[model samples]
Target: MSTLTTPHRPSGAAPHRPYRPSGLTWTVLRLHRTALYVWGAALLAAVAALIWLLAAGPDARAIVGGCDASEPFPIDCGTAHWTTTARIHASGLALVSACVTFQIYAVAVWAGAALTGRELESGTARLAWTQSVTPARWLATRLAVPAVLLTAGTTLAVLLLNWTRRAGRGDLSGGWFTMNVFISSGPVAVGYALAGLALGALAGLVLRRALPAAAAALAAAYVLHEVLDGFRMSLWPAETVTGRAALQLPHGTLVLEHGAVTGAGERLSNNMACVGTDSAAALERCVERTGLTDFWTTYQPESHFWPLQLVESGLLLAVTGLAAAAAFALLRRQHS
Candidate 1:
């Protein structure tokens, strides 16, 4: 009786909001939550490792004297250099470095196998399409969710890595030019992750089979990684230091090429015969005979680090945009 007289509501009254994803978007998220969980766990672990390294870094430096000496001769600083603390810190760094290096491949594989390929192969995507979600929307949802998650996670990881590397400083961290250090310590890491996601989605859509898609994604990601790594140093013009007297490069300079130059400023390749000289006097004779007026060194000083990082990251993000565009176009054509 009371229900029969149900209370009147205003025409413009707002409906009760439920906490859940709706439609195909919800379906996509629900299906991929496991992968999301794994990603979160891995990120948390990396953060923990970085924090541990930060705390233990000083002890590691103390054991190894921070390797700060600028002597011309190598010092045999002994077994203390390899103390347990140092080893642990090194291991932590290695683990973090590995995560940054391999994250692209991992993203590609997961995107191919779990996000797109598996859904298409299993007919779930088709089923969703039948239920009012257009193919374009389906694909967009697939890419968007992962893109948001990958961006956040990768950005956080990179910032944490930069902090950790700064914390360790001195000899405990890799040089700025080192591949892993360079990639992990800046925005390029996020770009790589997004590119991997886009490429993997494309691979999955093209292959439509989980295993093959995963393999293709991995191969594509590796090729991209290699290409970027090779091109990194060339992203910015290097500065050259020329001196008639032997000079020590400023610390932390990323030397690109160092060899003899003529007074006319012509660059010369390294002469093997000259390089083979073991004695300083022999080297001097070789330099004199070669018409070398000065030793010229081309290098990227530490100041170039940010410029290089920004350039590389911009290129990678462009690649990501292309891959995403291609995937969307392909999906639209298939549906049309």
Candidate 2:
């Protein structure tokens, strides 16, 4: 047998990474089991319950009977609804609750905040990170699963909400559901996970102890998540002059300073309509102030879904990127 001598490969650049799945992912999945179950299972549970309610509940028309003809705002039922105002709002609220404003996003960010910050404190995460896996990659892959699952969960939850909302669209009160729910891989969701992940990764890489980090991450993320995500927009109420008793816009953040109103008969410079829910809200504040044709009483308050999601998510992602980079940099410098 002639042994052919193969030429040694010259080193110029690293070879392309093979398409095989990284076994590191298994470690991530293993590390993230509790967090996933807590967030994912809870979300799935909520969705399943929603599905059941939607499937089992009375049809919208049956509940509605002939309420479209009433005063305030009426749809095409055209017969002048005889129902009381309370019943109108009650019936309309089913659709309202399905909105991102009302339920899905509310549940998701809160749920994610809960999931991300608690891992290290429990002494659970370090079991994997101490191995060949770098702490940054470990944290990233761990967070990636839940973020993905929750994003899909939000999308599906919103879809189901849409399905329920569609059933009642013949009624104007039901139109709130017709508006899209803006939960995507958007900044808010990413920010939420990042909030947790950053805090946790910081704890893991810096503190080297999971429990303290987990507890602190969860507590801090919990306290700050909404404030940060909404950028204090949701924290304060934006007074309207009662042209209509419009619910505050989700994308249109209102800040309230008690006993402050403008001389021009406007609510206040900061408290009223400073941020309207427009598609352009995604751009920097220098881009636009007022929203599009979205803030009218003819529609529900949360018609601008995407902008809110984008703003919150954008802030989160920005912070997350910075945080991950910082963690990676810190870990690289560690003596261990």
Candidate 3:
């Protein structure tokens, strides 16, 4: 009675804290921390390279005579042009494009092999379900964590790519509609990433074996990529420029179709005979004989860049949603 006694706590009992519901999310993140680190490092590298390219842009343009000057000039100009061109082709634009493309494929493989398939194959997914986590919540956590990280990484890369491309655009060799350029330069990068994630998850759930799932996911991703590439130009209605004389397409225009058109607007195959000759009179005669009233060129202008990007992005996002929904539905069916 005379001594003050401290309350004894149970050895097995831990300190009480406010309820926090991020355990599953935290677990997913911790398990994949290595991947996160690699992704972060790659992203940082890409960003640094992009910034360097941006900074070097003015010099590159000056070397190339500011995008408007004729080629084959002074020795210094030639050296500068060659150096800039080599750098861009080898490490600048090409590097960024490869990085983004690799990310999409890597995400698909990881999602299938490490994220969902392995867990299910090892029976840990079942064990987690026993620990009061529903299959839905478990799968949600799995997909959501990677999805968030992928979106952020992809978005940053895309923004950096856009900056780099815009800065060095005048000196760059490719058009905006170039497949690699288009994919890396806009929100479609993020969309592709998301689609990869969803496709991978679906592959994982379906196969439940890491290696097979990874392969399946990779194949699905490639098919999606090819489909998107084929349909991209059709996303927006192209503008047509027609002239009685051979019309000169603007620099950087993405020509979808170019052929001879009669005055009544009948499109015909291009007259190859008129090509590769310096004589304008021969071209004129060819056009006259072909009854070509005008040379019509269907093209996506530089101005249509945003519209095409948005449309492709939207379609990709929609595909992501469908794949995600399918995965969830399959999970529910299997678990229930």
What TM-score does model 3 achieve against the real structure? 0.82
As for TM-score, the candidate ahead, 1 or 3, is 3
Instruction: Report every candidate's CA lDDT.
Output: 0.81, 0.47, 0.81
Write model 2 residue lDDT over 150-245, tens digit each, in one string. Answer: 557556655665564355332433332222223322234334544555555554555554455455555555565546544434423334433213
Prediction-by-prediction clash tally: 0, 13, 0
lDDT of 3 by residue, 4-116 (tens): 88789899999879986569988997888898899889888888887777777656556445432464666766666677666664467786887786667898998999889
TM-score of each: 0.81, 0.50, 0.82
Q: For model 1, how does the per-residue alpha-carbon lDDT over 77-105 read when each residue is reduced to its tens digit?
A: 43445565556666677678768877999
Please give the lDDT score for candidate 1: 0.81
Is 2 or 3 the stronger prediction by TM-score? 3
Flag regions of model 1 displaced more than 4 Å. 1-23, 59-82, 244-246, 261-267, 271-292
lDDT score, residue 166, model 3?
Answer: 62
